[model samples]
Target: PPLFRRYQVNVLVDHSESKGAPVVYEDHPTYNNLIGRIEHIAQMGALVTDFNLIKPGALHRANGGYLILDARQLLLQPYAWDGLKRALRSREVRIESLSQVLSLVSTVSLEPEPIPLDVKVVLIGERLLYYLLYQLDPDFGELFKVEADFNEEIPRTPENNLLYARLIGTIARKEGLRPFDRGAVARVIEHSARMADDAEKLSIHLLSTADLLREADYWAGVAGNGVVTADDVQRAIDAQIHRADRLRELVQEEIKRGTILIDTTGERVGQVNGLSVIQLGNFAFGRPNRITARVRLGKGEVVDIEREVELGGPIHSKGVLILSGFLGARYAAERPLSLSASLVFEQSYSGVEGDSASLAELCALLSSLAEVPIRQSLAVTGSVNQHGEVQAIGGVNEKIEGFFDVCKTRGLTGEQGVIIPATNVQHLMLRQDVIEAVKAGQFHIYPVQTVDQGIELLTGIPAGERDEEGNFPEGSINQLVEARLIELAEKQRAFAAPRKEAGGEEEEIKEEEGGDERTE
Candidate 1:
């Protein structure tokens, strides 16, 4: 009768103060935090527990509604994933002590009855993690049946542009920032396209767009304007770049001071400027690398020094091999390829990747073979195939601006320009300064479809096509290169002829000696 009078009851889930179903987001989904835990209290130097010490977990609180979690965090916690899966499978939450679950300690503990679960669970993560779980975890598909995919960018159609402008207005209002004028909206849309790195698409990365809007608002306030103007947005964008470009500035400084030798004028045989993009976190910038080639007479072997030294990635090595294929197919189809050439990225101490520099390397090799000088003022970026077709590369905008910055520092002559794949023409979202310079005839951007077009642009010589009889035009770059290859092949044959005759004479002397031995 006394124990019955002192009985206690614990309320784990209380919704008396709420009107709707509860929704919970568990930031840290540990084992005990996912499934309810029976907590113990230490009394008089001894551990003690009771029914009143029971604590409700996220599952209990979110019962009858919804629960959200970060997939990465759930996987990182010990037993958290298993506990969530167990609850989902059984449609109920069970509370148990950690020691009880592991059988580490079995003195005594209360096991609360399971609570019925009616909540829907949602996990947010990258596509990579989702794919990993779908492949590795058999239960993942059963639990997460529906999927929603979000695009990083949307097509930059006129209708979409209007919708994007409306989205910008919504963000401004929600953030309590100054309203953007029509010109300001247009500028923001242009910036979105730049962020997407496609002139025909706009980035939908809401966080970045929101940040830009907030920064523009701050600049607008500083300018004492009630509404954000295009000038303010431009200032904001410039300020953002200025903040993240310390490394880029240091690289440019090295080039400006001549510490890193990059030629911006004149011409040199077997040398061309190549562009590469360096991405650091949210900032990406391009720099020009001096790619040079040297050739001599030998059994045809085109060597990539970077690959030999283990400083080149597989893709870069593949590009070098492709160069050899192009040369053999174009110049040595009827004869043996007799040229030995080596390509290197001068002053490149770090690892090199990507096939974007293949076009530049090929051009440099052609220059060395033909003894033609390529203009140092021009840089090239693109991937080339065995057929000599130039393919588009990533980061075209950054590559162009990179060379333009270097040339601007050294005084841009009318001859300074960059040759890009003609297909990449649709991706040009250049900076205003560079665009102005192009309009003023101080700088240029040339898009080419084939290696011939690129080579002809790099060197002021014609890239002569093969006639029906398979002869290149005289004095043309191709003619020079083919003639050089033919000469090397002839020299190789001449050297082999003398060795063959000497071997024949030795064999005759051996035969005479053997005949004398037979007579004896």
Candidate 2:
């Protein structure tokens, strides 16, 4: 459902769940009258407070039953948790100047009507909310003992999808519309999959569904159609594009003018492609990658790399493991080695998290060590394992587009492109400019299922075949990495072993001590 519709539903559900004290407005006597001055209600040992008058204003009025709150909104309120907890524990609801915490408003002690405290409180919010609460608040376990998490999309089984389509039809009818074309329903399901962040379930989130339906309405009205059709959905998307026309216009103007460098013609040494994720609200854009690293191998197999400098995320830890694993397996498979490598997101400044850039880091490191030039055009993201497979990641679209935006702004000369996981292709819905660029042969997006594929794409050369023994060609990156790891492992063992004495100094010391003892 839409946000507003959801609010309406909550109200209906709350009332249905109870015959409680009525919802009082700010001016209602139950609320307007001072708690201390209330002789009638207070005399019954039921007193309300004004402490949380700011939020949970609904909480006080509907105190005897359920108090529904959005977890995100509650967290946004300053001291909201403490205030709510106080009210629940005191079994008293308060009305007060919302400024009690931050302002100079005097804290008013109100009548302590036992917060009947039996009302079931339901908090609706993102899944992250639960994790945040548990991680930050030690007292959370005591308060919210029971959690009922709602699924965004219900399972998209035959029965469920059929009912979901019926639900969509029901929504269309409620809008005073005729119906929807079957394909339009399928589009909704596709969108639902995107919204739910899953494939198995056909459940598109209610909020997203409501928005799409509303947008579909606008398009239907435009087309003068009695029944909303797929055309209407496409029209809505177009309408949204029009709204963003201004941004697109500026970017395109810049691209045409050649103010930015987006083409991949000038390949640089010690650099590999990577992806960056740019999140705007619930929508995200992925940009193509550029990772540059300067590396020096030392005595042990450890990759001492700072993430903030290399990948730009707040130390996700995975980045470190990735680089270490690649180095251990490829460079020094037989030994540990010390290494100093500094990797950087060549053009990134903000929007951080994840060691997803670790694969790119490894690529850069190997390129630097082998003195090979990575393809300037192909940027890569995804955490690589010891076996060199390209893993799937979130914000794939954002990372792709962010790079694309930079490249496009510079100039996509048909060969300008990025390489990502093959699984990410379905998520590709390019913006108008990007789609146009692709159509015009100005840009490209290639997906790879394996590291060899990614490396081949990035280097613009075939990654050589492995021998019968599963060894890469001697001069290949794999060989360089293996040699390095083996050297590091040997260094680690040598350092770990006890050192041999140069002149048996301990024996001389023992003899001197024995002579001293005889003299004594």
Candidate 3:
């Protein structure tokens, strides 16, 4: 009970009610607001000042305790950081008017004795601001020597998970909300892992978790339920999505209206659905773009149209370059890569960023080179390396659900599914309906570890292995790509052969003409 009593904390400086040890949260830490200012009072006509004229500020109230300041807000305010630093360094909070600081005050002002600044200043900010201050301001490093790093996630062990559920219960009770049933608590923990995007970890974002619990409790009250159940939590989650999913709806509408070309069911050569995530503020969702590739005879150059026009970020460019490496290592070890290919995200006007779409791009390029058709019913999201290994990516859940929603909007064919990196399978905390569909064979999720695995899934053909001579089996995708490259090389040599003969003929005729002129 005593420990529980310790949780009963007082709110200080909440609209100027300073009780107990005053802890200040300076949201707008202006120079005058952070340090106390002097005021002028007119006594009988002339300006006069007394000890009562001195107004205390955040630093004055937070003395002998803690002063919480947002580093971003502090720096944004003019001279606020410098003034705060001076007080901390001198161990005193000074009271002075801005007019006095600027020498604009002609009348006398009260210069109160500086109070001892004994409060601990806690600067909360992102990692960038901390590093910038450490590198740019030497004073920042001297004053702020200790650094406490808070990870976004904690290990999801059984004991930790139980503790997390208990923490949620504690918050619910503190907020005067209905108790969460066992199922609701378990769902919240699972949602925590989903937010962390990891199966073995849970997010420690208490504020967000509390918000979810509060919303679930509200839904429980609306349903006249005494306790919050799993259904209430689901409703709260769905309502949150419904509230913030306007952009997602518009994107889906565009797809349905045929403005954004995405094929939910079909088979096409040199085309595949590439899944990407679009984040607007705190809300993020997945979008499917049609990535296409065209092959021609030239030097081995896979031209990324996005990168050429500076629409691709560095990671996207690197992923495309890795495709070239995969092609050379897999098919063109002995011969020059005498083929030029161009890849583009069809109908996508915005700049493309991550390599999560690289797997789809590679599939499109392979289908073009091999004359194979990729099933357009399936969409893919993954990053690839030079070794043809598929890697994990962020927003795996959104990407899968994005494609699922689109497919559901049109019609959920049994063949319509998504292929994600095998490593991302642990991150699958999908909706109940989706899980049910997968169980009923109405949808599928193929976890692929390598490019070959993904290609086999996409093309329904065996990605055959090489034999004794390091050549792929006949009619395999790799064999077809190699054969196409060899044909292009031969054609390149053939075209150059006639050019060489024509140049020789022109030189010989010029020599003959010079001799005729000499004879004349």
Candidate 4:
């Protein structure tokens, strides 16, 4: 009956066999797994337990060391977060049965003595979770105070490129893959920049980079090569696309089959091609949508059809509002905006998001107002501000490639191209085929800084600058738009004048009749 027994000591974690403090990563951090658990033996229809059955959890094993956990997984497990917090706050690990914690057991149970805890707990999760915990959980700030944020990418400078090449070499060696030659390393670095979506930065996503290396090694072996080459790396990349591009192929097929109405040639008034990216899991590709605008005389309202029907997101609505501001600030500054315009993405049934199509929408509206046809061969992507300055957007490369694939499918006209924000030119790490088409003058990528430049490029007419007299050039796109707006305003005034005159006549007649009645 003595408390100190010879057979009672349980060695849950043995550090005597190791050299340093233990670093434990609990992939599944359940409540029992995190704070230890007690086991019992059923003898003669009764449960008997002892200290020897007490098993240590991650916290117990990582005591006086470090414990790494996934924040999402830890939160997903019931009572796991509370137990971990209790251990951290009290500076000790306590073991208890789930039934006892829930008060479901009526029988007496053994409680293990609390173990002294001195360990660092690290949680790996998305930035959103960290912020959510900081805002929602009061104990989070006090417990996990230090935060280490790792950048998804690093600058692709000459020095960093060498370092990245070394990193690639290290990973290849660690993974026991074939050694990559200099060209292959260069290709990988370029691909990293592409993954980062910036030509000036390389992605630091190690898992993706490592996977690419492994796949490249497999390709090298298949090709009977001793070392991985640039071709092997490119093959690996192509294989990845081939595996995930089923949806993209189907979309392109739809476009080619005339099921989707995207024009690669000709000219149309008030219509332009707008590029959008569709992201499916790890794969993203671009598709072109036709944006069109119609204008009439009204009380200065620009209706976004997508927003009216609740198919557009807030950002898209904001972009449409910005277009109204731009129109008023530019064309209607000296007069009331008497034009009502409706903008829509033709054949779009799904919800639309992002402001990247703002520039395209504006161009279409301008074309409608000016009655100048926009070239259907050119696709557009970028966000435009009230000042008409083109702003950069994400997935620039995909947008361009998406349009290019569509154009190439229809047999590339030499006039086919894409208009993107000037700032987004730095993000153009396009596919080799697209690049080759550009180099061969079969396709084009136009980087525009302002709406005027883009409209001029699309319409093949001058986007006229205003003179000191506040008049646009006689035969320019701006002049035409201004003239049309003035005409609409004048017509609106003329239409309102008759009602005013009729009201004035009625009031005079009533006044005369009142005088006659007073005389009687």
Q: Global CA lDDT of candidate 3, please?
A: 0.89
Candidate whose lDDT is highest: 4
Better of 1 and 3 by TM-score: 1
Candidate 1's displacement at residue 169, Å, is: 2.0
Best by TM-score: 4
- Runs in model 2 deviating more than 4 A are 1-144, 197-203, 241-260, 265-268, 295-311, 335-340, 401-417, 422-450, 460-471, 480-520
Cα lDDT tens digits for candidate 3, 309-355: 99898989999999999999888888889999999998877788889
> What does candidate 4's lDDT look like per residue over 369-411, in tens digits?
9999999999999999999999999999999999999989889
Model 2 poorest 10 in a row by lDDT: 31-40
Q: For model 1, which pairs clash?
A: none
lDDT of 2 by residue, 1-520 (tens): 3335323422211455546454432222222221212222242576543322223355555556556666676666666666666666666755454444356756455433333444556666788889888898887777788887765557768888888888898887786755788877877766676555456656556666877888987778777887778778767766664664564455445545655233456676678766666554555445454567776646433342344445344544566566666666654555445666666554455545786776677677777765668878766777667677777777665566667767765666777776767776755544556677778887777787767677666765556666898777876666665555556456655665645463477778999999999999
Looking at candidate 1, what is the lDDT of residue 41?
79
Q: What's the C-alpha lDDT at position 152 in model 2?
A: 57
Candidate 3, which segments miss by more than 4 Å at Cα?
A: 1-28
lDDT of 1 by residue, 72-191 (tens): 999999889988998899998888766777789868678778888899999998999999999999999998899988899999999999999999999999999999999999999999
Distance (Å) between predicted and true CA of 367, model 3? 0.7
By lDDT rank, best first, the candidates go: 4, 1, 3, 2
